[model samples]
Target: METTPAPSNVDPNRTLLLVDDDDILRERLARALAKRGYAVTTAPSVAAGITAARSNPPRYAVCDLRLADGNGLDVIAAIRDINPDARVVMLTGYGNIATAVAAVKAGAVDYMAKPADADDIDAALQASGDTKPEPPDRPMSADRVRWEHINRIYELCERNVSETARRLNMHRRTLQRILAKHSPR
Candidate 1:
């Protein structure tokens, strides 16, 4: 529930709502955005976040896909309910196709996996809609794809290593090794 107070230079009209259960991550992001001239309001649960948005809907929002009380999609709905033009980004540690689809359906402007930094979030929020979608300049490396797939399965299995290993038909030790390594770029 603790939040960093906005400085005098921040614009009162340009509010941002950040909803996440992780205390450390929430605080860090709030400070970063506040430094960038936003008046940031933070909440740890769906109800609190919705209430904050209803009171003074933010122009921007960053919501975690999973919260202690409910899904972040609910927060998205609340934000959109008050400010249809509000830009929202959904964050998740367990990135997957299904959840990503759900996020889009719920009105998120973008979806990002965990380990995303403040700069990344900021960039997504500020990206203009005037550009056309283009094909990637380069395809992802096989290793990167494999790493993402493994992580997705692990998350779907509720972080149970054994179950994930079995589902992937991978050796338990091999799965452990992959999980232990940093995600491939």
Candidate 2:
């Protein structure tokens, strides 16, 4: 879908909220974002982040999908309530396409893995897409989530079916069954 550009010049009125469970990373990101000319508020958990967003909605938000109290979606929802126009981004270390798709479905302008730089955050805020795509083309679905999870586990296990199955809380036979059902001959 087509997108518009947010103002290139940083606006003082456009503040940012940085939400992550990692204290050190959150502090570092907060300082970095502040230096970039954004008035930033940092939160250590989903609940705290939601509280902060409710108090004063930010124009931009960078949130970790996994948080101590809950998922970042709750924080994103709070921000939406406070400021529907705010651009939200989900930053996660568990960089699975499934989660990224889910984040976008949950109202993120975009979703990116962690260890991202300021530029990534900037790009996400400038994206004009909504939580869901326009008609016809839809977001990822349950089958995608399951397949993604299975593939991720398999990758970690170096394609060892037993190991992947154990980690996924499924039997080896079950994993094999799914793989056999899904894999191309």
Candidate 3:
């Protein structure tokens, strides 16, 4: 996606809250948003995100769906309490219909699966109420979904092959083979 230049007449007072447990992602996205002319405040957990919102609520926010401390939805709620007009987007590595619905119900303006770039995010944040942003038209194939699920579980298991294998009820060799292959499209 092409990067959007910040509006020529930028709003200096419009800050954006970015919350995510991944340090690299948070930092990188923060830089991108900053380049886009937003004052970005970042947090690593639900508590921190909420605290930041309470201290100085932002006009726009991007929250991870799953955080190390708690669900990102709570942060969204806090932002809404502080600034009901805040436009929020929920990001997730394990995106699904249920959670997408929950995010909208929790006052998120948009939801995006993992691997979303700065341009995609900027587009989501800038989109107007009359036009809702939509995800890719093609859904992940079953094999791709299974691959993603396994990878998520493996990561959660600290990349322990045996543990991931046991948790997934798959043989160790099979798990290894799956992990060795490139991710499906």
| Candidate 2: tens digits of C-alpha lDDT, residues 84-183 | 8888889886778788788877778877655556755765576566433222233345576567668756866899998898888998997888877763
- Residue 115, candidate 1: alpha-carbon lDDT: 49
Candidate 3 residue 156 C-alpha distance from true site, Å: 1.0
Whole-model lDDT per candidate: 0.84, 0.75, 0.86
Worst 10 residues of 1 by lDDT: 130-139
Candidate 2 residue pairs in backbone clash: none
Query: Distance (Å) between predicted and true CA of 70, model 2?
Result: 1.0
The 10-residue segment with the lowest total lDDT in model 3: 1-10
How would you encode candidate 1's per-residue C-alpha lDDT over 1-185 as one tens digit per residue? 44568888987776889999878889899999888888899999999999889887789999999898989999999899899889888998778999999998888888887645677777778776633223244445678877877887897799999999999999999999999999887
Q: What ranges in model 3 sit over 4 Å off?
A: 1-10, 134-149, 181-185
TM-score of each candidate structure, all chains considered together = 0.73, 0.63, 0.81
Model 1 per-residue lDDT at 155: 77
Count of clashes, each model: 0, 0, 0
